[model samples]
Target: MSRNAKINTLLLVLVAALAVLPLAFGLGDHKEEPFTGADAEAETAITEIDPDYEPWFSPLYEPPSGEIESALFALQAAVGAGVLTYYFGLRRGRRQGEARALARLRAEADADAGDEAASERRRV
Candidate 1:
């Protein structure tokens, strides 16, 4: 193998070894200890919550029933489809406008060339 290739391989290996060495050696002496009185108190407080409190859902405005849930899903899908369709339509219209502008410029250039040719012919 070439010297450069050997050097690159050695560098890559060195980086990988360096990266792993810290992670391997950084697992420094972990010694487990029993939880203290404060830890026990905190655990107890968490477990002692009032049972009567109503749970809060992730999304608060979720529909409760089958029909309502289906309607909400359908509404969301329709809105998404509408937005996509509008965006695609706008993009398509812009492309069409650009094509029209290019065609108009080409036609004007052709017309100007024709006029220039006619004027040259008259001068002769």
Candidate 2:
């Protein structure tokens, strides 16, 4: 295959491996809750270290269940990804537009120079 195609395929494979390898190997299998968030783990650790510890503040809003909390987290991630995608797309489009404008300007200048040369030849 072509160089670019090979590179793209390699990147796709690497991304898939990154996503799959951790799950496949069960990297966090030793943990009590393998898929638990860091916040929950930290809370457990803190409470274990200090039984009478009290929080200075609490969340303004809390989801009713773990499923809802996961859903909200996923939604937040999706929104963040969308925002980043939009920003990058906008930047790419602007770059393409600027490149096209520069190319058009160069072509016009060359054409104008050619026309001037023809006119001078006719005058001579």
TM-score for all models, in order of appearance: 0.47, 0.67
Number of clashing residue pairs, candidate 1:
0
lDDT at residue 31 of model 2 (Cα atoms) = 75
Best by TM-score: 2
Please write out the lDDT profile of model 1 over residues 16-77, one tens digit for every residue.
Answer: 99878855875433524333346766655666785455436567576889799889889999
Candidate 2, which ten residues in sequence have the lowest lDDT sum? 31-40
Tell me the tens digit of each residue's lDDT in model 2 across 52-71: 99999998999999899899
lDDT per prediction?
0.82, 0.95
Which stretches in model 1 have alpha-carbon errors above 4 Å? 1-65
